[model samples]
Target: MKRINLSDKVITALKSDIASGKLKKGTKIPSEPELMERYEVGRSTIREAIKTLAMSGILKVQQGSGTFVASKIKSETLAQRLRRADFEEINAVRSLLEIEIVRLACLNRTDKDISAMQDHLIQRKKAIETDQQQKCTDADIAFHVSIAKASKNKVLVDLYQNFTSVIRDFFTKRKEENMTYFARSHKWHEELALAIINRNQESAVQLIKTLLNNNY
Candidate 1:
């Protein structure tokens, strides 16, 4: 079994405490040292966990004042909210994201970005040939994420990264028989990389539309 990271464990413990009302909203949390001892983790682990909670709006950090529970209910991040969306809804949003990503990528992409896409495509092909479902899913996502990065839009890249987690889950739940889709879509993916490399903005955009519409 994989060991959970220490900071993640602390985060879960803290959230549980909040949910049970042991750490009520508006109450200041223990000092860093106290938290370290309570969780039996190092100071860095405690700090990392607290920082994550703060980012999620579960905890409020006031410099020199200490941290407090901002809400008994954890504020949902966009990625968390996305987990509830159906595949169709997520794909609709994906279409919007990728269209703009490809457009920007065509304009901004560097040779390094093109290399990343090509490498992922190779991994994708190898995964399909070896019938490695997980690798195929990873490479497919990576290929698109490379495009998002190539676009030079940090916000778009972050959004796509979150959206891909839900997509990864979708890939895992699929029946083995559905592996055929990966095989069939490989050529389209190859073409997409080529279009991006060639800086053919229109071709890249059209390919993305077709890829998304085909439900691949």
Candidate 2:
């Protein structure tokens, strides 16, 4: 089996052990070598599983000490949960996030940030012109991700990155005929970028709202 699938199995096994009280919270887990022996996988696969669980708040790793069970119940990360969320739910949160991001970006964006946003928009336009749905979707997300980074808020940038992954998945699953949305919204994205470059907070926020209203 592939290493990714192997790591997933290890993660599931570890979670099951924790849920079953076999690996109690606050208890140190088996060493890397021990885990490798048990799962019959390489050290890298076991380490990847541990890392993923650690990020999700299931396991905790201490440098030079050991890995330990942090939670008895599985705590799903935002990225994991977002995959299961519907478009309406994701969009509602995204709308709120984008509005705030654009507002802050307008105030905080630097020449570098503006240049990155402009580059993504250029790629987005090219993707649309080529009728490459997946590339268009990627470029669209990149454009907004640049905006989020310009917010000068680390938390917002992380949340938007995770949330946009879900949006990217949603876009990929869409039929070819449904991809007009990306093309239609390209102009609005250009306008939003310009608004941010001009540091027009009100106009940036309103343009984001318009994009959201039009289901872009």
Candidate 3:
């Protein structure tokens, strides 16, 4: 029983250490004897804990070469990061980042930019009614991408696209969902389009933040 508890305890501590970068990637773990002494656990428990972590892709165990944090495992890309990233929290990041982008776009967006957004909104409306769900998803992505590009800063545009992919992944992995989210999202985006067209940068920023917070 002590061994079982120790195994779990060591696993948790090791995971925390790895995530904090204290146990750097590709750096070998202490020997079983060392871990047992440091943790005050039996060798078997230490071994078992290491084995579990290795199986989970959190560690690499090379026979005789010793156990090390897996090089490919990164806290930023891990579930630990997502545990701290609540839904719509990303929208806050977007609001902060994009508010400035909108200000820049106000100065930079050309007639072509407005035309592109109009075409995107049209397709988005049509996609919403279509039976193909994937088309609807693509249109949603495209609408946002167009707005980001209108900022005329290629870096901001790319960053927003990256963020969009992550947000979409979260939504796709959820259980029960409602189309009401889509309807509300579309309405808010319409407001967003109008604000941009008028070059009301501040209103566009605030409206996007409000829409993200309220839409759920």
Candidate 4:
């Protein structure tokens, strides 16, 4: 992993404080002198950190007044907050996005997209049969990503790709707890593939919702 600089560390600490309600919205952050003392950093490092946070919409800097938490942060800032969220919270958001992906995929998928999804489903089944947890997880993510691509929406595809880590973490934790998770997942993948291929929009949506809900 790349090393985090002192300024980045300061940004993360401030963000954590804000998220934990220690620094509420519109609350003024510590002054430069106080921050330098608190973080044991020099003037330049503290100024750079504050500038970075302000640019990211996590902070608002005033010429005369001290820096305060922004009243409204960017959506990307909100996504950063969600990155630290629990599995259930992440899964709930994933399910909502993927349900729409499935609906659009059923309406828009091409033959090639369907073929790719089929291949991913086969890969998932084989990985599960061989008890290859990592391969199974990769194939499962690819299967959903294939559906996202079939939706013909670049933004949706990118959003799903961004969620890949959270999705993988969720799968890894569940598989560790339940040995049969992948086996059941393989069956659901097969059903989902057929639903998308047949253009069964409702079935595709419900199948994905069920899979995310662990009803498979």
lDDT for model 3, please: 0.75
Candidates' RMSD to native? 12.4, 11.5, 5.7, 10.3
* TM-score per candidate: 0.67, 0.66, 0.62, 0.64
Q: What is the lDDT of residue 90 in candidate 3?
A: 67
Q: Which parts of model 3 have CA positions greater than 4 angstroms off?
A: 1-84, 170-178
Which lDDT tens digits does candidate 4 get at residues 52-96?
888888899988988899954333444555678876777778888
Instruction: Return whichever of 3 and 4 wins on TM-score.
Output: 4
Residue lDDT tens for model 2, 40-61: 9999999999999999999999
Worst 10 residues of 4 by lDDT: 71-80
Residues 1-216, model 1: lDDT tens digits: 112499889998889789778899999999999988887888878888889999999999999898999998655688887998877899999899999999999989999999999999999999999998888888999999999999999999999999988878777777475469999988999998888888899999999998888877
| Model 3 Cα shift for residue 188 (angstroms) | 3.2
**Cα deviation of 191 in candidate 2 (Å)?**
0.5
Residues 1-216 of candidate 3 have per-residue lDDT tens digits of: 877998999998888788788888889988888888888988788889998998888899998788888854445643345446765676667677667776766667788888888888778777666644456567777777787888989988867776776666755765135344665578778888888888888888787777666642
For model 4, what is the C-alpha lDDT against the true structure? Answer: 0.82
> How close to the true structure is residue 123 of candidate 4, measured as C-alpha lDDT?
88
Which TM-score value belongs to model 4?
A: 0.64
